[model samples]
Target chain A: MAEDHKMTYADPWMLPETKGFWEALNDGKLVIRTCNDCGRGHHFPRAMCPHCYSSNLEWKESDGTGTIYSFTAQQVKGGGKYVYAYVEIADRVRAITNIVDCDPDALQIGQKVKAAFRPSASGQNILVFTPA
Target chain B: MTAHDARLVGAYELPYRHAPDKSLAQMQAEAALGAVADAGLSLKDVDGFFCGGDTPGMGPMSLIEYLNITPRYVDSTETGGNSYVSHVARAARAIDAGLCDVALITLAGKPRTPAKGSRPMTDSNKPDQDFELTYHPTVPANYALAAQRHMYEYGTTSEQLAWIKVAASHHAQHNPHALLKDVVTVEDVVNSPMVASPLHRFDCCVITDGGGALILAKSEIAKRLNRPSVKILGTGEAVKHQGAGDIDLTWTAGKWAAEKAWKMSGCTPDQIQYASIYDSFTITVLLEIEDLGFCKPGHGGGFVAEGNLISGKGKLPFNTDGGGLCSNHPGNRGGMTKVIEAVRQLRGEAHPAVQVPDCALALAHGTGGSLGTRHGASTLILARED
Candidate 1:
């Protein structure tokens, strides 16, 4: 059979460079931004430190652990339910992410969670926090 | 410039004329220039600048490069629609602190982007890396989810949300420049196509290219100006959460901002004769009505649906200029439009048809982003004479 002409090529610019965040996920570790100047760590990693405005920063692999700060269960029509979380990692850093591998209603604040990477569409992976 | 004794000495707003073809930058410059002229000042007097991140040239550094104005204090805070109102207070404080004598706060429409049909999703920054984008949960879907929650918790019907759009459209009928000038009924809103669950096409705000600006100066300078000074009695900003995961989507950080603004302005909810709550979605206004203490929690659906939000007989009139729901809302410019309406009502210059009767105390509020995530609210309290 001839190749279907229905397939369209994805744009080159569409690829997101998330290897840094995903690489740590593959290693069963969570990575966050740690500032050398102020000794603070943050989720949603950035090249420059937000607290001290220091460009000098390093990546610290988390203990694959954290506690839930807060969360919300979202239900979209035609889409299943899922709970998003505010997780507090080491060094007083908090991030808004998702807690997976658990029932949405069973989620609790201060629940211990560990990092896990799961395969996603397009040969990529995502970081999901599960109860430790 | 003095201490942090910031006050809104003057404000200006132009009608929301639809100009989808104009570039965002041109609209921004026009608005800024008009505001300066209205204040009887010149751009040369502007020493500080603030604007929304969505503008053509945004960020403190980027806008300065684009506008070619060397502002001592420059900020491009992007908290969505409320950014303008919050920037107003921030610029006012900057002016009072002597950081700048005249501050220019302006925002234009969202510049069109080619790749995504709209601006890339926030999570697009980490697309291959971010999981949320994979679900295709754009803002409309996010708002749809929140609207569902509101319906679940408060028995808030889709019809209730439609009432806000109906009331806003009613006001827009008198506003010649309003994009949706025709009056609509609750039935019309319900029958409209559902863009997302619980939100119809009519429930959403219109997108048009426009700009607005306000020139804030010290009291000494404002006192001598020819135009009536719309003294900024108080300004406050609050963020409920940086993202949708933190707060109860039904409640908002707007409550906190209003708490501070009302306390500082020395006014109570009962004193406010008119209000301008951002109407990105009809549900947003419903949430603000309750959050701002205008009505009890879980009563927003009733407050708006039962004709309380309409002008004249209503205890608190809202969006006399049609609002984002029925007016031309070019992204973050909605907030500035709200403030301008309040100032005009205070000055008794609102178009005769939509003018609030004897408007003495006014409240303007704005919120951006979907429910439960990164909510931004700015509340401003203004009095005719302070």
Candidate 2:
């Protein structure tokens, strides 16, 4: 994908605990942090399980198959247009992302989607989604 | 002092179109002074101060100095637009606890003004900022997410949501100072340029430069004032967020807030003649109506369709002053005006064309932040004191 197509938003201000999540995306794979203590998973890789407050967390590669929970295309006046959505991925964990390589208008809730790694403004591979 | 012992003796929404010449402080100070004088009370009478994020400088300290009045008690809770709404509960409790006799709550903002370059209020360093901001999650983006989920969940349509903006336009036509007074139609709303899918440009509220203020006094002070006082019957506030990724986007925390306010006020939805629901977007009013118990959760589409929220024409007259949708949204916050309009309805001081008949009881509610994510909800119930 061309660099100009990425969202105008700035790159992620990474933290130590969540660095591996972004690194995996750069390698064209998606990852979710899972709580070893409670068997729950979370996205955007947190230090602890938000569900159970357990610090027993580990990196787990995800197949990146998901269903679009809700989606909307933001068309900024005189600016770029992109579709951002919450896709229920990694066993129902909602991941914030954009739906790329597809028609924004054709997207629907509950539509099946798969990961598409695209270059972000900072040249990091950002994980987006497209119709599977 | 007892619960519900505070009465709104004064409320003033600056007759705002645009104030490019005014500083944020000037707007807020003028609003503060306006309410003080409206209550027939002197500036000396304000011994308590309540403010939110819109206020310039460090909390209320700078504003207190700018106003040149010393308030012995103060609260500077900043919950976006819901700050002023929640301030009402804080001010009333402070007054009841003898923290202050006369309390002044103020809000001012200039978001509509062309920016001279400034950063957002929230730092980009928040834990979730990096994760969310990169997705281009603008204000409309967040609400559009909820709007889309709502449509999918309850078979809601773009046309049904357009009715909300249509109703607001009808009421705005009666308000000369309304930012949009042309009286738009449902078709017009649905056809407006789409800024965010499930949300047309017309479905969104106008961004305007203006401010408003409120004055709450102890019941005795209110009785002494010559102005008609609106008694604060009940107040409730709640917060909502995506609970551990089990996020629900269809409804807001407004249900929880409304329930608490209803239980406190001992009043039901049937008793409210007028409503000042925050209209950040047309979809917001829809969800709020359902959450406030005006109708069941999924029935909001039908409840607002066919001109259900238009003043003097619908079952409930909402946002007669046009709300944040048509009227000015100072500081880009919608909470202060909701409280101000409710007070106007309760005092029978609203524009006569849109005023509710009898106008005995009214409700004002505010939702701050975004519906798609973490947000605060506040609700207030007020009644006329004969």
Candidate 3:
């Protein structure tokens, strides 16, 4: 019975959209997310809100500036590893990010932080944060 | 306000017990008996059963069948780990709607303690099996992805995460029923062999075998039974996703539940006297504290490391009976113990050595999985009227 089942295969990381996002990051300029409409600031680039069902949303250049609303340390090892942080930009939106190149102990809550581009484990310029 | 209309008249939960080899039915029966006695009632007094959907223990109908409960109301509400306490609000509505008078909530059995791979195999019976579990990615691995992502995005350190173990173990030292009461250090958490990358042995919650139960009835039932009434002040729920792609991972849905719960209870985070957040892992609690608005976000690691979760001097007195991380975790029934702790504190019945003073409002938060993919979360507010 087991042999009758052909193994179905899939790759988790081969996303066309993610590849495009990474390409933008490599230029040290966060991508201007292109969506159907609703031109505005989209920090974590996405084609849809999954909310208003308004696929009509476009990404623009954010100041790359925000404040650390909350964060936690992860001890479990693997790439994509660093202190996870929630950055609040433009008053209401929060994006998940990694804070790097600083003392882990020194990062504080509500401290101003800004995002910068760096080559990520995925071989793309990913936006990382540092204390402002 | 008339006593008869209050949603919660009486509630009682027994001290948690560890009995790994025993069947779920037996534990439920024992806990049910204790709850009955606490309310000055008997099994005959109970008219309903509510439990998580797929616990190894008895389901509401199965418990009714095995225990001969014969209740008119039965709830097998399974969102995830918070299922039991979530039952409280539903049971109250059921009682208010005159479906039943007393709802007996019970959970039993041991899925955590090592027993030759008794882990509930992922449900692969569905046609979507190819999409869900055919890849051999287990729950821990799903959590591992979130953990790794958190590490990548935040630069949160091993020492800070290890502090969750260090701090939880400190609270466990005072809990007589805790499975691991010996205090551990950050080194112990770091050195422990990795279960999945970024998660060490101590970072993960220990598997435990235990049973807990609670009795819930209308406000009038409290006066009639002569038991102190700890009203079910508020309850709330939030859903993230059933699959990985839908999960945001770092920003939890549980805190959203807590926010609604606080609004429903008419209480603020600072007004809560004690908290029993479900601790499947230390990170879960850390995130919860922030999301619940107890501490500013990102401050959870530092808040926990600085002895802020301890009983006497911390900014908040938390999990005085040891949390699921240190206490017994019988799958989703972990919520029962959390509510029980709140009830005890509100009734001024906790072991005097560990009890909080004048505790009128208590909060219990439950989280089901890592980064909570398919996460089910609920926050319950219980209060004692002066």
DockQ of all models, two decimals each? 0.08, 0.70, 0.05
Off by over 4 Å in 3: A1-132, B1-21, B54-59, B112-128, B242-246, B370-372
Encode model 1's per-residue lDDT on B1-386: one tens digit a residue: 21234445556555555555555666677788888888888887888888887665336666556667888888788788889889878887787678888888887764332112555545445522243443334455556555656676788898889989888887889888887889999899999976655678898888766768888888788877887766667777888753312235567888899988887877789988889999888878888889899999888888888667778756778998888888768653479888888888888878787788777788999987656456689998877754
- Each prediction's interface RMSD? 7.6, 1.6, 9.7
By descending lDDT, how would the candidates be arranged? 2, 1, 3
Report the lDDT of model 3 for residue B158.
69
lDDT of 3 by residue, A1-132 (tens): 011212222322324434555555566655444345433444334456443446666555556777775554433334222455556654445555566665544666678888775543445455667777
State the lDDT at A46 in candidate 1.
60
TM-score of 1: 0.75
Docking class of 1: incorrect
Candidate 2 reaches a DockQ of: 0.70
lDDT of 1 at B263: 76
Residue B252 C-alpha lDDT in model 2: 91
lDDT-superior candidate, 1 or 3: 1
Residue pairs clashing, model 2: B109-B331
